[model samples]
Target: MRVCLIASGSKGNAVYLQSGESRILVDAGFAARELSRRLELIGVEAQSLDAVFVSHEHGDHCRGLGPLARRYQLPVYMNPETFQALPSLGRVADLHHFDTGSAFTCRDLHVETIPLTHDAARPVAYVVETREGRIGIATDLGIATRLVRERLKGCRVLILEANHDETMLRDGPYPWPLKHRIRGNHGHLSNGDCADLLGDLLWDGLETVFLAHMSETNNRAELALECVQRVLEKQNLCRPQIVVGRQSESSICVSL
Candidate 1:
């Protein structure tokens, strides 16, 4: 399995996954033109995607879903509520709605949907199983529950949320209401929260970790990396390859 974080930040987010003959996109937050450009940079074509799996109804996760799916005639998978809440996604040729917590297959890949705490409609995280091993993608959630830790176990590569640094967020310029929302139960994960989650998720087979969905204003890549690194050091665990997902570009493709 090969995974590339196409883009990840408050502005937009997408991920590309390939295993065997299947090429899947986890989200399509950018405009069609921009998404196509990013895919091209990573040597993938927009029309070549097998399917699109939406995590929620938030614009940063699904803004381009309608156009992308319509253009490519791609199948879109999401929970029922999310599909209902999505803004007028025009004439999606193939819509497959799965219940949250159900497991489904797309070609050779098996996907398990785990419900997440987020403001968007029926938000969920995906744990994808490939021939090599499992790859987990869980961003945009505020807290990591026990179920999240369990589902992420044994994953070879994990794309987990490291949305902000608490101190920065508390002192940042966002209005009080917006700041409160970001730090609330359904908001986003902080660096400290991410580090703690990483400590719980560490295992022998966890080969790579990508810290994703970072806040542009409230967090620095270096700070996020440092927090996770500190946790690894405290636990005396072997350091895994860590990549910071960027807003403007695709992350280097990682293979398992």
Candidate 2:
């Protein structure tokens, strides 16, 4: 399986995962042009994508879906409420609706959805099966859930959220209401939450973990790494090799 994080953050997020003839995009948050350039940089063409699986209706996750789907005539998938919430996406040729916690398939890939704890209408994370190994993509989450733990328990590669530092978020520049929401049960998960979750996984050595959707305004890469590494050390678990995905540049394609 080849995993490439094209962009990740609060502003926008997208990841490209491909195995054999199956090319799947987790989110299409950028414009068609930007997505095209990023894919080309990683040696893929937009038209080659078999399907686009959307996580939520948030603009940062599905902003570019309309244009990209229209351009490539690609099939798009999302839950019913999210699909209805989307601003009249004018360019979509096909739209498939799946329940938030259901399993679905597209071409040569198998996807099992894990419900998310966000304010959006029925968001989900996906556990994808490829020939090489299983990959789990979880982001924009608030607190970790039992469903999420079950889905991600055995993933060979994980792209999960490490969106903020709890203290920083509590004492940062965000207004009072926003801060309360962020630290609530349905807001984003802090770095500490990520560490706690990682401690539960029976991960093999150097298990690839892409810390994605980091809050640029509220978190730092080194700090995020430190938080997660400490927990792994305590549990005598292998410190999963971690890479922070950026919100702008496309990262090197990694294979498992």
Candidate 1 wrongly placed segments (more than 4 Å): none
Candidate 2: residue 84 lDDT (0-100): 82
lDDT string for model 2 (165-209, tens) is: 987887789999998888887888889888788777656633688
Question: What C-alpha lDDT, on a 0 to 100 scale, does residue 62 get in candidate 2?
Answer: 87
Supply the TM-score for candidate 1: 0.98
Highest TM-score scorer: 1
Model 2, C-alpha of 112: deviation from truth (Å): 0.1
Q: What is the per-residue lDDT of model 1 for residues 1-256, given as tens digits with 9 covering 90 to 100?
A: 8899999999999999999979999999999889999999989989999999999989899889999999889999999899889657778879998999999988998999999988888899999998998999999886798898888888889999999999999999999999999999899999999999989889878889999999999999999999999888877566789999999899999987
The 0-to-1 C-alpha lDDT of every candidate, in the order given, reads 0.92, 0.86
Off by over 4 Å in 2: none
Q: Candidate 2, residue 122: CA error in Å?
A: 0.7
